[model samples]
Target chain A: MIQVKDLKRTYVVGKVEVHALRGVSFEVEKGEFLAIMGPSGSGKSTLLHQLGLLDTPTSGEIRIAGVDVIGLSDHEKTIFRLNQLGYVFQEYAILPELTALENVYLPAMMRGERRVYYLKSGIDILETVGLGERLHHLPRELSGGEQQRVAVARALVNKPKILFADEPCANLDTESSRQILELFKKLNKDLEQTIVMVTHEEWHKEYMDRVIYLKDGLIEKM
Target chain B: MFEKFRVSLFLAYKYLTGGNKGITIFTIFILTLVFLQLVLVSAILGGATNRFNELMIDYQTGNVVIEPEEDTEYISDAHRLMSKINALPEVTGVSARIKGVGKIIYEDRSVGATVIGIDPLDENTVTKVNSAIVDGDFISKLDRGEIVLGREISGGYGALMESKSLGGVKVGDRVNLRIGSVDREFRVKGIYTTLFFLVDSSAYINKKDMEDILGVQDEAHEIAIKLNPGEDEEEFRKKLMGIGINEEIRVWREFAGIVELLTRTITQIGNILNLIGLLIAFVIIFIVIYINTINKRRQIGVQKAIGIGSNVIVASFVLQAIFYASFGMFLGFFAMQYLITPYTVTHPIQLPIGPVILSLSNTEALFRAALLFFATILASFIPAYKVAREDLLKLIWD
Candidate 1:
């Protein structure tokens, strides 16, 4: 479960202050698949970043699993991110030097898991994402859709409590985008995995348990 | 800490061997060449100094020497002092010499040379003068009236001699010697060379002949003493002073003032060379790692975002530097031990002081290797820190 109370974020470009999030507040219960929909610069990605502990909020309170995470130190935040949350970026940000298996197991490795345990878990997750045959291929050798599947497998390998995806299908074709969305639906239903996704597509609303729309920096509709 | 180090080491090894094989091999080659240069520069300087010291000890000064007292032309009661010195437990051999300046004339050519009168048998014990003979035999008695001409005095064509010829004086040729108001004729028994300019320009004769010519019988101008192996010359000098001998005593190091200065000069040059080597290594590693980390800036940010600490990323780069430096130094050690040292020892480089052979002690080699390793660490640290501290969001997005 996640909770946010009046979270705000701002950035200074040259001398002007741009408020990316203006006291926006929201919550998602455990096992819920949520999507945040908005136009460009609606603070959708900004809100996700703040909730995911990727960046600090200008002013706000954020609690995950009933614990205040806003006050955690940098080191504590890194540990929390490693043990409790995972991220899937739009660009398929797998390390080029690592094989698909290496990329998937990296987060588990960072969590101080043993190599054999993480390797087995990573292979199982890759198989679930239908990438069992490409475990040894590098990111560059994989097709765009396959690379995205590897990224998804990597995000799920650590068995985190929540997965944060920022425009995961933004760079995929129509068919790949539909496949990825179906994969997310299956993960949510079969594994009871909780996920928060940001997207601009209107058709993805059918798969989400709930959809929140934003205009400018505040919640406009739900 | 061990876990972190293991992960770092794994990442470093993977990155090093994974991509751009040409660049990796080129960088390693450059490091190997630099390490070899550092070893050779220091070895050559040390070799030159050691060669000079060996020559001075072998051909000129023994471990210790006693000269005439200040303001005295010759030592008084020289035979009594010699006997006392020879009685010491540390003394190995003692040679008393009568030194005088003389003009030598042979076959219408003449040159001024230092004439030394030495007891042949005793002189052999103090210094390897007999082994230096290049022509004819050494004088067998103190009254042979035979003179051994130094290679420089006889031919005047050697590393340390002037170009003026001595009329091509050869063995079995008779030469005239004039010291003060005494003139004598003696046959040139042999030509000997010590490879030292000063020693090779002097002539040696029977001690009895020198006494008769100079009218200073039963006195010696110098007494050279050779000590047993491992005996400390300065300690023995103090002990000899305890015997109440009234003469100026000096060690071989003190007698060879020029060689001492040369040793210090070479050591200072070696220090400068080491500094230059360090600077070169630092710059090379800095640039190599800087470019490497810069290329991986985005990957570094992604790693940080995925809960990897900055320390782990920095450790990976440092480990890469350590690998390159350690491997290069290891190869350099083998090259010095198996290739350079043996070749130089067998065919020494001819120098003005003497023949120079490479010298590399184990401690010296290890110290240089460690110095280079630390320098590489520092070099890699600077760039790694810069890359590690960058804002992750900008790196990931930009």
Candidate 2:
């Protein structure tokens, strides 16, 4: 479960005050698959980042699983992110120097998981994502869709409570996008994996349990 | 803590080996060249000065010298002092000499030179005068009207002034020596060269002959003493004083004050060279790691986003620097110890003072290597800290 009360974010750009999020508030229950839809510069990604604990809000409170995360120190926040949440960026943020298996197991390594268990769990997740054959391949060697799948596998390796994806299918073709959406649907339905995704595509509604639309930094429709 | 180190090491290894192989090798090569410069530059400088010191000890001044007391032209009871010094357990050899400044004449060519009178057999024991002979034979008791001239003296006053041979006289040529109204003609028995301008411009004669000619019987102007291996010259000088000898006693270092000063100056220069070498290494590593971290900014941001600590990322870059420095220094040490040092020993550089070889001790090598290692770590740390402290949001999105 996640809760946000009047979360606001502001940025200063060359002596100009830019309000990316204007007191937006929302909530999602456990096991829910939510998607935020908005036009360009509508604060969808900014809201997602704030909820995912990737950036601090200007003045607001955020609670995940009933714990207030606003006042956590930087180190405590990193540990919280490691143990409770995972992220899949829009650009398939897999490290280029690492193999698919290495990329998947990096968070596990950071969590101090033993080598044997980390390797086994990494392989299992990659296999579940239909990427067992490409475990040894680098990110550059894989196609965009495959790289996103690897990112998804990496996000799942630590068994975090929630997965945050910001435009996961932005760089994929229609067919590849459908496959990734179907994968997300299966993960949500079968494993009861909670996910919050940001997207501009309208047709992805089939997989999202609830969709919120935003316009100009505020909730316009739900 | 161990787990943190393990993770840092793993990431460092992956980044180092998974990158372009050519760049890795080239970076290591540059590090090797820098380490070599750090080592060889100081060693060469040290070698030249060390060679000068050895020459002074071996050819000019022995381990210790005993001079006549102040206001006395010659030491009284010289034979008694020589016998007592020779009997000391630490004494290896002792040679008493009579020194006098004399004017030399060679068929209209005249010059002033220091004439040192030595007991030929005992002199060879204290100094390598016998070994430095370049022409003819060393003096003997049976040869009375014989003298040995240094190369510069025998070559004439013009040669001595210009430090080049005028070719006026040769070995076996007859020359006249005048010391304080005493004139004597003698045949030059040999011409010796020590490659030292001062030593090569002086002459030598039999001690008994010198005392008789100068009318200073039963006296010596100086006594040179050579000690056995590992004997302390200062302790020996103190021992001579303890035994009630009234003459002034000085060690080789004291007698060769100018050479000692030059040696200290060279050592200071060597320290500057070391500092410059370290600075170069620091700048090189700083720029290299800075560029590398800049190129990997996005990946660093991603790692931070995924909950890898900033300290872990900094540790990885520091580890890479340590690897570069340690490996490069290892190669440099190998070359200096097994290749460069032995080769130079066998084929020394011919300097004006003597032959010079690379002179680096094991302790010195290790100290310099450690210095370079820490310098490189410091170099890498600054940029790594800067990159690690950047905001993850800005790093990823910017």
Candidate 3:
């Protein structure tokens, strides 16, 4: 369901150019739970960002569900992301002012679905993430684990074909992190949800169907 | 477009209601002050202009005046014309006056003045000069040699042009008036000051005495007429013309050349002050909204990331600014009409011209409100667009 070929990204900090991704190529099949693992500054998060269409790479090609996302206009890209892709940030980036239910339903609302349909879908997804009791709570009112669950519910509300998590549990404690990982594993096994997650922990590879390792901006192992 | 507007509105309402209450209220308060500043200068200038017109109507020309036809010295058979004018139902009062240029001599000083002869009883019905006596009683119609002098001619009661006056003439002091070949000694019964320098340079005496000096019987230089409230002066002039009264008739505004010039000068200054007030409002609102939007940079990025469209985010901020401006203008208009203006009516502001009240025309108020609304839209849109259009990763992370 996804394809990448020689995707490269670079950044200029002051006068020096640092290559984050160098000639990396990979692909994931449908219904697969994949984990991208690497040490710090090894292009793991950079690759996820490129595939998620959150940032454009300096050079390369990427296709998800057979659409050339890199060639789409900015507006078309936003619509594509809204309709087909979802992202969970490292910070559990739900809007602070919105209630959990509101946060989960926002993307569906932007997609122009009926209010009742979006509300029901948002509620069902929140319940699936074990956050049914925290539907009306704000981000600040929820614990770290509960807020992360809300982010997961938001990502799933649009029924995206591909879900991307960029170190989603970077700020969580050990128990909360385990709960999030178990929820992801259940989603992949029961619902056949395809997810690409980036992590540094070696134990997280146990829940993944396939694992890829990166070293110095290039694929080192698969 | 409608859907986008709906989203923008939702976000604006949520932010305004759920955001920091102190900042919202403070920004609204500042906008209210700016609106007031925008209109107060013009309102005060309007009040001064109104006051000027009022003085002319009250002390110089009663709503309408009838002068002699062109190339003629006087309106012939003035008494018959006065009676014909008084016969109309709209005419409240009419008075005929014989005017002559002369000099008034008191002690060793003499000053040029316009000598006017008025029927004291008829003059009282047309003008409020009778009520403006500051020193002594107004002259009675039967008092033949008694006269009334304005402070500009009498020279002591805070006269603006005191040096050009007759020095210090006192009530009951005898003053000599020289009109052409006619010179008469008269007792000053009263001194009045209208605070209008032009109107205060004239002296009044009994019409019978003026007729004898000017040697014209049953003729007048001009006839002043007062009408009931809401009477149309031009329509009345047409009615007089329809009656075959062929004479030069004019509304009081035609006699306001000098006052009109003064008001125009003040209005120019008022326009400059209004421009400065709008600029200050723009800078103030821009800074307040810029800081507020800058603080929400990460939130804006998240909204954009979740497919909220950059246009929607920017429109939300513009909507907030419009709400702020609308509320501020409404409160300012309310306070001016109900509280500030009424207070001035009870306790007028003492200006050098006279006691002045603020006059706020709805047209001017509405025009200024539109200008303020424009300023608010531009002030909020710039910052919101700047923040929303930035790089997405930088927005979410930095």
Top-DockQ structure, candidate number: 2
In candidate 2, what are the lDDT values of residues A123-156, reduced to their tens digit?
9999998999999999999999999999998988
- Residue B247, candidate 3: alpha-carbon lDDT: 96
Mind sharing the TM-score for model 1? Answer: 0.84
lDDT of 3 at B96: 98
Please give the fraction of native interface contacts (Cα pairs under 8 Å between A and B) kept by each candidate. Answer: 0.46, 0.70, 0.34
Q: Tens digit of lDDT per residue, candidate 2, span B55-159?
A: 677777788999988998888888889999999999888888998798878887777889888888778778887788888887886668788888788885334
Off by over 4 Å in 1: B62-95, B100-115, B121-126, B129-193, B198-203, B213-257
The DockQ scores of all candidates, in the order shown, are 0.54, 0.72, 0.59
Candidate 1 chain B least-lDDT 10 residues: B156-165
DockQ (0 to 1) for model 2: 0.72
Against the reference, the lDDT scores of all candidates come to 0.86, 0.86, 0.90
> lDDT, candidate 2, residue B217?
78
- Itemize residue pairs with steric clashes in candidate 2: none
* Whole-model lDDT, model 1: 0.86
Model 3 chain B weakest lDDT span, ten residues long:
B1-10
The regions of model 3 sitting more than 4 angstroms off are none
* Deviation of model 2 at B75, angstroms: 5.8
> Which scores better on DockQ, 1 or 3?
3
Candidate 3: tens digits of C-alpha lDDT, residues B339-363? 8888989998899899999999999
